[model samples]
Target: MNNLPIGFYVDNLYCFPVGPSGSQRFCYLPTTPRIEVLGNEVKARILNSDDAAVLALQIVWEADTDTIEKAKSEIKNRYPELSFINLSLADFRGVTATLNINKNDKVIYSIGPINTSGPDMFRAAFQDTLKSAEKEAVLNAFNTGESGVITIVYDGYLKLNEIADAEFDGDLATEIKALAPREVEEKGKGFFSKKHKILTPSPSLQECKDAVGKAIENKSLIIQHKDSANVSKKAKDTVIQEIINDISQCVFTKIEEVGKNSQYISSYCCRIKKTKAESVKFNLKKSYDLVGTISESRGRDIIEK
Candidate 1:
């Protein structure tokens, strides 16, 4: 198996020097013999011209499982041809390679000195770095205009046997659940069933008073209400009376039923006199629940010089 071409294997492990400051170096045997470096750590692809086979490698630094899964879903949806493969450090044992940075800079990169502290110390760091690179590559392909044609190699250092034992944090699970799409049930209602329109809640007395005050300050008032055909005439008169009592200076300049009978009620367009007083004060605490009977009820200042 080791003698096969690099593309024959689903994954290949290769290491390049981090820097000259690191210590401890050695190479062990790979489970399979085919090894190749297709590109820089950001993006690469192993290929066998004779076999017409290729395997893509993408590096990202993300550790969150949700993000990785989402990226995988997006990539699969967009490309559909490539598969994502996550790699861990344990997949490859002792491996050594000589890399030439430039004409003058040559360095030896190794994986596994089983008896030494180097592999243990660098394993976590290497895993994190690889994960980061994979995440970057995945995001670049998805978010930008780049083609989503690569199969991301997940962190290979993770032991295959231990994968089943790994678990995501509870918060991450909760977040994923929250983000997942919820199914909305479709209800079959009888033709005569009471169909209710979603209406905004009625304003409290304090809120109404504040609106009046604002209208007074702006020198105008425009009261808008949907036609409440369901509400009795007495109730509509009561609401209009309450408004008049609260703002004594304001007069109903116009009232019209504009829409068809399907409209719940007629709309009211009222004009109020602008008072020079610093504030308009009113102490009516009665609750009208106006919006409860109608779909829309709002008061605004329609400035008129």
Candidate 2:
């Protein structure tokens, strides 16, 4: 499992179902999100860089004790909680909020992803481990009250598609792309207008993706040229990234190993190619400080563009 070394700022990590209907389940406000949740999420804690460091250590310590000791030695001094209140109330645009953890996990959980590959869907399941005092405190808060005041910071792997290539992401996508040859069972198919529409194409998943790319490029939404339909670079580029984002999330949802266990796609930090729908592998220098502060608003301003 590859641990992702990047972060995204969520305005409020507490947007669950308001009632037992289980119908309404998504929200993304660019400003202070006014969600109407019942008695929960008030315990949410807005994290600072140091607080993030603590959580990171909790994750790392479970894997390597030496690394945790070294990390603890070098982490920044704890700061006041007043510093990161801005993140708890942000308006991140276009990230799919459909990923979910285990049902047993007391933390936030979303719906399982749609995988056309087979009847079996890959859901995130964590091994049982006793939480340390510090780790317990953080989870107690992360799982508790987060209605609309606290932002979420996840430390995980970037999607193989987000890394742009198999080489950059240790052939993560290459492995998945290879799985294309396997036989799949037709399940999880949905219908509209009383017609069945399989989310994952039966035998042409890659072919369908390629065709989509070509169609999007050829018939762009915003036609730049009056005579040409595929002339708008802006709309094409924007939609292309969105497509990549969807594929990446699909990778995250369907392929449990490709998520935090692989690498993280920074919608807030990294940039996708304006001309191509795919992203490329990052040749990030192996530095502790670079990993020390994984803020999405590092190079970019915290204020929304």
Candidate 3:
């Protein structure tokens, strides 16, 4: 079994708690991978040597020196066909090892160092790093037309610290409760969120009269003929008169011919006598269609002209 390709191994030398007070320390030396339980400081069975180094770190964090030594001894006795080197996290320097199974079989191992403050932090960082390394290694092996399993092993011990619960004073808690609830700002969907204005079609003639009356009171009116090919001079003059009769005041400007397709159209710029602000106060119902028709007929380019 030892002659078969094993997994990757990473070794690190870090301080370990040795005594009851958890202060007595030593440089942890992990030779074989093992399983350990947290808090209870229990060393479980030795894991297969092919296990990942990050996994070993989990067990190693909870393991004591004697347990680790015994596990190492057992591995040596059980798998004499396999050979491994003792590496420390402190001395880690991108070392790689290869296990020779037979004339045809070989497994490669990449080792590295992890700098962490405590077992909890180490566990999180080690898990992320190991996952990345495993992915990379598998991809590399596949690219080389090779098949192999990735095993990570880390040798080191991290001191476990008891996390304290947070406490709040009675006055502070009361103050917090007295604070007003924060209002959540509505966020737009950025480029995806759009306010589309659904324009109503032109209103009926009666509706147009009402809207024109209101619009003239507040807003200036600008009317321009758009359909040069279809609209006649009589139609234009009739429309302008209809508007003038409905509005309180109307001023008809000079007609200007536009368009190059032998299509002549006139523009009638008129203004309401009321101030812009007062004109806005006029509320007319069902005037949207008339306004829409006026705006659309003028065409967007008409503003520039």
Candidate 4:
């Protein structure tokens, strides 16, 4: 049987990295990052031992009986950091890959060598009655899904490009005032005491207002539905049945449309002020480091000069 396909996801760990100028032989530990707008603290635990720049990932996957062996072998070889168990049965739930950053502006790139196993609900369901053949047949037929998370211990943070802050209350005046790059000023004097200056700022308050207004407009949620009362119906006993003359006239088209639109609003925003975050300025320079495990065969050491 064909092995199940792997889905992808990025367990976001927002950061800002300040690496050593030019080039350095070592990566520093990453610090806990705080959301600048909301003041929410994201504590990132550092997981490095001695001098090896380590990245530990605890991958809990679900695979069926036929594909379990292949999945385990692939994971074990791809990520030397995971210490997986001897069990093959079930399906994957989700997917994705990842890397971490710190506040000081440096990207730490490496993977840990250790895979651990956990109790899966599907595998444990067949406690004592289902025979091995029955269990194998059942496991071979189901599809659960796969997902993973990498807890970064190395000290780093990520500074992404400044997009609109999504968290600000949809107040035009308030966002304009907060987003202003500079402020109005005054100096000593009473009547003529205080010297007032009119600062014509670039991207004036009106421009700021328009920008925020547009951003809000772009992120607005809209749902469309048709009223059922308008549809001519007949009272068949206590139930209302549509008196349709044509069999092709669909009734739930509007409902299905609404459901489709709802899918757009399914997930929350990121890094957009009130949302989670990502960026184009966010660079990915480490090659093979994020996915491969520590190999003694390489025999190359990266230490400070």
Question: Which numbered prediction scores highest in lDDT against the true structure?
Answer: 3
Comparing 2 and 3 by lDDT, which wins?
A: 3
lDDT string, candidate 1, 54-113, tens digits? 323222221234433443344345435434423222223232221111111211222221
Q: How many clashes in each candidate? A: 34, 16, 13, 59
Candidate 3: misplaced stretches above 4 Å? 1-28, 35-62, 65-112, 117-124, 129-148, 153-305
Residue range 121-239, candidate 3, lDDT tens digits: 22312222233444344333323423223233333322222111111111112111112123234445687775543322222344434545454355444443322221234544555
- Pairwise TM-score winner, candidates 2 and 4: 4
* Model 2: lDDT to the true structure: 0.26
lDDT digits (tens) for residues 84-140 of candidate 4: 433222222221223332212343222332221222421110012222332222222
TM-score, ranked from best to worst: 3, 4, 2, 1
TM-score of each: 0.14, 0.14, 0.17, 0.16
lDDT of 3 at 125: 24
Find the candidate with the highest TM-score and give its number: 3
> Which 10-residue window of candidate 1 scores lowest in summed lDDT?
162-171
Residue 65, candidate 4: how far off, in angstroms? Answer: 9.2
- lDDT of each model, Cα atoms only? 0.26, 0.26, 0.29, 0.25
Q: In model 3, how large is the Cα lDDT of residue 93?
A: 20
Per-residue lDDT value at 267 in model 2: 23
